[model samples]
Target chain A: MSLDTAEVRAERAERSGSRAYLSLFKALGRGWIRDRSQIFFTILLPLMFMVLLASVFGSGDTAASRIVAVGDVAVLDGADPDAFTVVEAFDLDEALAMMRDGDADAAVVQDGATVRIYPSATNSTSGAIAEGKLSALVDDVNVEVLSAAAPGEPVLETEVEEADGGALRPIQYLAPGILAWGVAISGVFGAAGTIVDWKRDKLLRRLRLTPASVRTFLGAKVSVNLVVAVGQTAVFLAVAALGFGLQLSAWTWFAVPLVLLGTLAFLAIGVVIGGIAQTSPAAAGLSNLVTMPMAFVSGAFYPLALSPEWVQAISYLSPMRYLNEALQSVVVYGEPPSAVLPQIGFLAAFAAIVALVSWKTFKFDEL
Target chain B: MDAAIEVADLRKTYRGRRTGEIRAVDGVSFRVERGEFFGILGPNGAGKTTTLEIVEGLRKPDSGTVRLLGRSPWPHSPELTGRLGVQLQASAFFEFLTAREQIETFAELYGATKSRAAEMLDLVGLAEHANVRCEKLSGGQQQRLSIACALVGDPELVFLDEPTAALDPQARRNLWDLMRSINAEGRTVVLTTHYMEEAEALCDRVAIMDAGKIRAVGTPAGFVRDLDAPTKVTVAAGQLSGERVRELAAGETVNADETAVVFETRDPRGLLTALASDGALEGLSVRTANLEDVFLHVTGREWRG
Candidate 1:
């Protein structure tokens, strides 16, 4: 079709725009790859820390074995000479408390005639196995005494009670933490820091000279970052489930979205931290400082129930905690985002606060 | 035709936190005619830049009115900016963009961006490095490229601040050729520099500015003529008498020492006849006074500073 002069001019303008956009992309892509080490620290490193650390620190292997401190050595009074050292002597309540505190993986709660193992009902086999070992230890000591005094002397052995399955697997524990981290990273790194860096580079100044609205620029960045964050979160969830046999329930549609929303919440926190910082170094540091304590206290690596009461109280204020709790409720507890809407509300509030502060405090030159 | 630039009673005070008010430009006033190669000659910190900024629309004066092409340049009218060009003394560009790309980007700013990007590149003798990044260009090339940027919009008036202030002799000569060619096209050029020789050679008319105001303004010949007339002077050492040198100087005593002497007078023939009588007018030189002498006569100092 033949075009008018105005149409021809418009076409040329469009072509020029396309060329400019391509040039911008090429430079940006090269710069991103060249600064790979920085990207590692800024993007991949924190998430790796979240996943690997949760795996290493949250395993339940040792949780199946009991370590009950023998108090007063009263039961070993008669067999002290012949028995093995460090035999896990059993006391019912103490053993139960040991297993509950996770200090003792399994506990031999011994009475006069019967021995009881109080592991979580989750791992009943571990309790039985632990009891068998304790009974064998007791019989072995008696056999030693009898064999020493009279050759071929017989010993009596009896069965005992066992508790349930041990606490939980590593992947099972880590799913929520990873989910929380993904949310926080999305909000902070994707939203606040990206905008702040652009502003600092005077890229914002160049863009401002154009006719594009501020809202449009911001919307484009957020949209890109959010889309990428979703993909990243999906990849991590898939990996954890497939590799570690983590029972990630795609059960309810709300579960993953809940986790994702939690991720977005913390991402907002990251955005604020990163955006508020004038330089990249400052942004990275501020985000990290907020992330580390949030990770530790908010049950990203451990249960909040395990932390100090005061720490648990502080976790209520932490957006990471809300994100973690919110995700854990969905991914582990089989709850929906609406069921934990209070938590979602808190996390959303945190994100809103951070975003507002970032918007206000952020400047192109810090001037 | 409207005057290219008009500034009346322009003043600019830089308010300092600790040092209080420092007046950078003080009630400076001047008019630049269309097609006039007006020169602003002054030493550093003489408010030359401040006055230029007011005209260029980069700055706002405290109290006076500044009209560029009959419009206020304070808010920087695009109509003015599009038709006017500037070569800032310390302008810089991205090092990564090739010289060609740099020119292309600037050219795209205007609608009828003369496809002369390459022609201009060839004009500046940078055709070979049209694809070379700005960082790789030599200092002179960079400055010329800056001049090329000003030339891009086909502006009617140009503001050149020390265009050749730091260039070497050859580069300065090359730039002078370009400036003459541009001036030959009848475009008004307002330039600031400390080089008196350059002003004398290139400027049609100059304002010898000092202390934030024009001390004198005229064509090169008019300025020199304004100096007291000394159409001729003679100095001879072969057999010159000390009395003869003093006698020739009559009014103010022309320079006299043991070996040589100097003379200045309203009438050269009578003075020469007097010296001839003493047989001491062996080597005499008669010539019109130049700008340097006129400036020294007017400003009472070396032109270099």
Candidate 2:
């Protein structure tokens, strides 16, 4: 066969994508650390809160030390004496009295049919231990349980583990709340605000004139946002586990994507806000219009169960609600995604549509 | 000859939802031969920017065609984009960036730029201030920086819209030198200005645009000569009547302004001597035809100042 060759005249297309991605990473990574005040608000403060609260609230997974009787109460009323402890009444009264003083781990006093159940909820571990131990001596015993610990934490963390359904740390109920809040603040506020600043700075316009593709630009931003959010989440997860001993180790896989989806959804929202805003102030205004009501009304800061019907209904419109709910269900109740897949799908669908709108509305100029 | 850039019957009208229609650029047409420094001069809101934007492939015309290097600019794809440089009118800059950083950044935008950003700064005479932030620079310095950005890609066609708008005298001269140097390198320059003096100084040829239409196009001298009443004969004369001045000229006579009677003429000596001997004129001086006089005669606007 005769040797024949065809020459190729390749035009420049691949460079656009590579250059655009590099710019995106540079923008996101630098933007994250560059503003020291923002870093503290978005990263450090939230991380500290997650760790401290998770540690203090999540320590309910324990079996207690052997029991000692109070000064007045001699023994268990049951005929089986083996179950009873015969400690002196003076120390028992002193111990029973210690419930108020934080000396005794827990104490029970005779009251009516309605017994006062208290461990220091302030001391979560102790509260859990106190509640668990009282149940063991429930029938025929008039009991007043008192706690010296504050509402958020207990010294002996036990009731959650031996509770009827499953053992869940308080942080389990709280992780989703924190993650959703972080994503909303960081993703929506971060992305939208940054875009506005970039436009104002002419950095974005400069990039638009370049060969950078839209897909590459957006993908890089999302990647950078996801990376920052993942780092923040890692800090939160670490704080929750190590600080409060709130174990979310079981549902790591479910948690990962749940967190990712929340971040993706908000980041897309940020793009939409930034794209549509005429100025940086306008972008901030846009974020405030959405974020303030969300931070207060959504379950990010507290349970929305007690909120008015309309308030709860309003939360349904919020992306935060779905994300927080999804996270809480997985971490707190160990509920699978199927139960909240509809909400996830809704969020994903909203994100897709918003992403498209952002792409469309985002002008290289102020158009 | 195949012009490097060609346009035919280009028209553009902007539509507002409530305000209805405003025709920014009415049907306009012109062409530029290869390696020509062409200037389009028009007053603000006279569709100068719109015309330049359309030709640069930045905006679409309502009706007509623009072919850049024998290619329609409407699609404005990257293949066509890389071949030209555009400095949009009143385009904002990233003030925080140093001049050198600004040049390097723009250079990176081009797929493979062999342009020496340092050389461009040197050409603009901004090498010493390369490290200074753009915002700290004077108005003239910024204008020079804008020019440097436009030339960073070693572009074949450069569209400089009001390139010297805010420049000081010295800066204008520096820019004029840079522009001639770029032309000497054989790059086609299409610029916009309201400065008749600048058009005369910088352009190889000039196209005077008015209210979205190109009124005339030729060399600077030709454009002035092509005006309806192209000639001027000034005299330190008593205020003469509109009719008494008519018989003094080769073509016709008209009032130059409040105190001057400008009579259109092929030969000013004939008209001047007649008035001089008759004592109808005094302090007589024949002025060479200029683009400003041409603009005033044609468009009825004092353009040079």
Candidate 3:
């Protein structure tokens, strides 16, 4: 009789597909968590970047230049109140004290016709901005004095108005971009690098010989990446709130879907790069080629509005731009979820389309 | 007598950069009987691995059929894979997982218990290093771990490609012993190697391949016995001069030097009788051709080269 009897055949066919998938997922997840280098790239490095970028760009009086005016400062005339916040000191000594103590970025002392402007050198950016606005105000006062002495006099005077809710610091605008940046870096490089490493090591080749299908393998990988992405977003948001006293809107809960969608979008892109690149080094280089430029143009570190109009137009092509806009709307503008529905829709569609493309192109086969 | 594997006229072609179309496995055919240790021996670029991959269902043959365990390997029938174990030439596992965990994970894929993983690891002599990461293991240890993974499912037929390629001599011998033990349990094994000695020592029957074709197929002793090469006799030059040895063998001398005198003869009996009568031929020895010589005579190239 044949050794392949009914009992033997039934025993062989009894392999559990779910257990196989769980095995792969558990193994990959353990590797991701245990490897110090992967953790550094996925979580620690991004968290470090958020802290560094937020501190540099989000903190301090990046909102508006603070000016302390003394005496009858005629030089302060016809200046845009939004340009600087001008405050009064009892005398030149108190104004100098305020400048010394960083309470004021600049001090203006008026001595009759001889008006003198003293700015703190330590706060050079703020001091320079205040100096420029005060110089224009002095010119306007001079024009008023000259015109009044001439025929048909038109007296022009300037009043200092404090900015509502104070100045907008660099950190205020940058907090959302930093969050988006964390998601992009971890999702793109993390996924692509891991896939390339698996290929280079021949791990995928080994797994192909088993009963596991490609769908099960990729499903496990995507599930792990999504979990890691969500965890990273939560940690960064909490740190941003605690460290910087960031005021996030109740609508900030929408960032969860935004983060997940953003992850899927970048993760799909990562799969495409990993599929095309033949080696780990090639994948790393290509990932940098994509993410480095996207970080700059997508307003991760700076506002796209500050860039040239053409560059701003190009930002529309970046998925990071949409994600950043959604996050900023929720965190900065405190806009309702309806305000970001378009961004959410675009990101979801982008993810679905790219994921489909990735599914078509991705393979365990060699390039 | 059932065939554990039956491959017929298998052909797989690949497009090469400068070589145009390269036939990796061209019309290769062989059968591995159940419960036998079958080996495929060849030098580098000899298509041994390609053919084995086709049999394992990892690669598709352009035009042919492969039946493993009485089921077609192509069309991705899991009946074969479920009962077949495979160890690729360079198998890699997750760098962070311990050897025990790696084996257990594979066992879980086969629906086997963790205890079975431990048993396999113990069988392969990796029990001591069970907690060690795969990346931290030595080359031989890693090879052993791969073998353990292959056996974790208690497979009926196993495929091992270059399992002992770069191992030390002792490790290779240990692996041979392990294979023998596995075969003793009525499991069939299919392995590929360029090591003629490994094939001679481990294989019950072997197919010698060259240029993507089987040059010869037989047992180790059968190949050597079938070769037309003659037996050789060598004596110390001080005992028997080359001239004297050649005179007795009558132009059957194949090689000689000042230090030794050598002669080739179809029948070593008469030559030895003559040499014994001479009595001066001390330190005399007779040698027969082996698989290496058979390879040279059959394929006209060194077995390794």
Candidate 4:
């Protein structure tokens, strides 16, 4: 009879353990959804970044460059009206001041036949484009003068062809990077801050007294995070497609799995931070210290091709880089799912390594 | 049948950067019988919490053997977990969860039904406040809610650590009644508290602990009786003159102030009868040794808590 009772108890424990896992999942998910601040930081903040960046650098139609023309130069008449928005300046100093104040991208001073152009130092990219446009216009004027001298002479022409078969707009690349960053922030900060708070509040100690297994507890946490990740992906893609004119292909569906993998990688890092940090503030600070710089270096805000070689090399160290690259491949570049296998491999390995570290450091009781 | 809890020579040491080595629990041993309302009473830093936590399997003692319901509690014995309920000194709940949600979650963790959770809330007189978030609950209410969550599992053994600490007198009294009812259900209760009156009122057996060790363990009445201390009887000083005081004091110690005359005697009935015959019972007051006096006698110091 005693043996039978023990068997019955064991069976009951097993049944309850499974039920506990489900309950824990539901409870955690509900808690996360109800927290107003967490929702803002993890979801709304990234979506806001997407909207802000897409508005500033989005679309195929580039804004005409603003230039301060110091004097009435005949060459200005030959410039492409659509490419330049000329603002008249009384003197060279005024033009230079306008360029300094960022009111203009470039300043053109026509001194007789020789015209000198000064690009704005602060706004280098647009300034360089403006300078190139003005230089081409001056070359066209010179060619017109030379053609009258030598009538019917053939001129050297240059034609441009896109290597990728089409122009990939900045917004197309930026949307995926921003989406990856959102996943990272949600995974890392959510995991780290929650763990530290739970530890400090003695919730973890309370949990230690329960019959629930660690596997069940972590399984619940990961499930809730994954569900939230899926929702985040959906909202991000919908806004990017409908509101921001971000094009999507059939391969974009692959972003779901990639985002989930990336979330796991970041969550593993979060677990490590949570295990190490003794306070919530410390966890937040550490998470920011890790993720903020990684966002830039991993090309979440800009392209890696524009960065120096050393920076691009360092980007290899950030898991966000792999996530961004994988997302960009499927979402922006329209590559097949198989093209992201290497990035998936890297994320999986990173998560595994950091998870081991977290396991080593995590303590159920403060004592 | 197995004892509900058996702890043997438990030792735990903490190394602090400034305090050096602190022996939190050193060579502590005790047993709690089935259905026993046992209390470990001590002042702050007396190792009561460390000892209780070790027994609850929340912390691993540096060296000890603890058995809960006939199985070792260390290394996380799952079979023993469902049989034991623990209410930690600090009450922590899932953030933003209502009282009902917190208890239900605990119930699920223990494999108990949600109805059992609701019943526990009612048992603790928190049924009406079930919808309030746990953080918004008053201190006493939170404590009661924690206790409810602890009992939701319906375990045979319950561990309560300073459950009534910081509560107002009325709340403390209410919690005391709640504790008594829990024990009345035949569950073995191991309570660690610094409140002498609390232990004296609720515990069947009390262990006076100080300096990381148990000074003595016995029923409250047994300890006080074995103390062999005298009871005091006092009367107005003007009612008894110096000559009368000398005559009345036969073999007991007599002390007289300008306001009162006091006598300490082992036989309180004899002294009271003599005072009554002398018509000296005016402004009379009788004082007997309680658990606090027992603690002072055993530990050779006044009780700090």
Give the DockQ (2 decimals) of all models: 0.09, 0.14, 0.56, 0.70
- Models 1 onward score TM values of 0.56, 0.69, 0.85, 0.94
For residues A190-244, write the lDDT of model 3, one tens digit per residue. 7788778877677776776677665677778888888888887777777778877
Candidate achieving higher TM-score, 1 or 3: 3
Report the lDDT tens digits of candidate 2 across residue range A299-364.
776668867888898888888888888877776666777877977897788788887887787775
* lDDT tens digits, residue span B1-305, model 2: 46789989989887889979878888888889999999988777788888877787666778999898888876536656677776665544543567876676566556445357788888888999998877788888887887787777778888888878877777788778888988889999998988888999999888878777787888987766565443567765465655566656534555656666666677666776787677765656666777877677667777634
Docking class of 1: incorrect
By TM-score: ranked, best first = 4, 3, 2, 1
Candidate 2 wrong stretches, greater than 4 Å: A1-12, A23-175, A194-224, A231-260, A271-276, A329-343, A357-365, B90-101, B113-115, B126-143, B228-289, B301-305
Better of 3 and 4 by DockQ: 4
Best by TM-score: 4
Compute the lDDT for candidate 4.
0.88
TM-score, cand. 3 vs. native: 0.85
lDDT of model 1 at position A109: 44
Of candidate 1 chain B, the 10-residue stretch with the lowest lDDT total is B105-114
lDDT of 1 by residue, B57-175 (tens): 56667889988888886553344666776777764443257788766655554333547676677777888989787767888998888778677767788888898977899999999
Model 3 stretches with alpha carbons more than 4 Å out: A1-15, A59-128, A132-169, B273-286
lDDT of residue B162 for candidate 1: 91
